[model samples]
Target: MTGNTHIVGGIAASLAFAQISNDNPVLLVGAGVIGALIPDICHGGSIIGRKFSIVSKVVTGVFGHRSFTHSLVFLFLIGALLHTLLTNDSIIAGILVGMVSHFILDMATKNGIKLLFPLKITVRFPITTRTGGAVENLVFAALSLLSVYFGYEAFAGYF
Candidate 1:
């Protein structure tokens, strides 16, 4: 999926977390946004990649695009690392959830992803739509609308 789609998914996931946890909404939202963009570090052309081109290039060289960094193993490892390093449980959970959301969204695209990695397994949805195609765009739009609604609800303390 495109960066915008990731952002939308991130926001939606964060809002869901907020509803469930009822903690500080802003911080969870921020973590979710970061988590959404974190997986694309291997692409070298994504929004996060452009901002940190050198790092992205190095990672891409080592893992290649949509490989280890985009896999479930990587997500678990990163989540474990973050949990060990960060003191807050909410933040760690938010990041992990956001990353999961990103991975799931990417899997929905036509190209799919090596979600298992190292094992050479690729999972995709039956829809067969391109990453940034009309279907993805529509999904992004729906996510955006949901995000807005949730954001408002969060701010208003309506969950």
Candidate 2:
């Protein structure tokens, strides 16, 4: 999946979290965006990767794309680290959910993802689409719509 799709997924996930947890949407959405982009740090062409080229090179050199960073082990480790560093439940949830959304989107791709790292296992939906293909564009459109829906549901009270 593309970065725009990940971003939309993050926004949708964060907005959904806000509606469920009744927390600050701004912080959650911020963290969510970070989380969504963080997993793609292995790809130098990724949204966050371009900004952190050194880290991207190191991570890609060590683990390769869609291997360790896309794994559930990394997700849990990040969750733990974030929990230890930050006490806000909503923010943590936002980040984790965003990351999960990344996993979900990647899993839908033809290349799939190594959801379970250190195990050399790949997990994906039975029906997967090529990255940036028509199916992916459709997925992106759907996520965009979901983001709008979740945004309205979460922020309607403020409006």
Candidate 3:
């Protein structure tokens, strides 16, 4: 999926989690938004990649696109690292959840994802959606709406 899709999905996932957890919704959503874009750092042309070119180049050179960086191990490692650095459990959990959502969305695409990197196992969900296609865009849009609604509910104490 594209960056926008990942972002919307991440925001939606974070919002949903926030509604359930009743923790700091802002922090969770922030971490989730960032986490969503974190996986695409392998592509130099991506928004996050272009913003952090050096990091993107290093990560792309080391793992390439949709390899180790896209794996669950990488997500866990990142979550742990962030937890250590930020010392915030909620943020760390949000990041992991957002990254997992991204990984799952990618798994539904035609290209799929190397979920078990180094093991050389490519997992596809059989749904077979095209990356950045109209359907994906629509899904993102709907997720965006859901995110907005959930965010408002969380902020307004409607839950």
The number of the candidate with the highest TM-score is: 2
Tens digit of per-residue lDDT, candidate 3, span 1-159: 888889888989998888788468888888888888889889899889999999999999998888888998897789678867987777887887789888888888988889898778888897778987888988888998999998897788645
Model 2 TM-score on a 0 to 1 scale: 0.95
Candidate 1 segments exceeding 4 Å error: none
Per-candidate alpha-carbon RMSD to the true structure: 1.7, 1.1, 1.8
lDDT string, candidate 2, 1-159, tens digits: 999999988988888888778678888888899899999999999999999999999999999999999998999999999989998877888899899989999999888999988888888999999888998888888888988888888778878
Candidate 1 lDDT at 117 equals 86
Better of 1 and 3 by TM-score: 1
Please say which candidate is ahead in lDDT: 1 or 2. Answer: 2
TM per model?
A: 0.92, 0.95, 0.91
Candidate 1 TM-score, true structure as reference: 0.92
Q: List the residue pairs that clash in candidate 1.
A: none
| Model 2 ranges with Cα > 4 A deviation | none
Give the deviation of candidate 2 from the true structure as CA RMSD: 1.1
> In model 3, which range of ten residues has the least summed lDDT?
150-159
In model 1, what is the error at residue 112, expressed in angstroms?
Answer: 0.6
RMSD of 1: 1.7
Q: Write the per-residue lDDT of candidate 1 for residues 1-159, one digit (tens) a residue.
A: 999899889989898778778567788888888999999999888989999999999999998888888898899899889978998876777787788889889888777889988888888777667877788888988898999988887788543
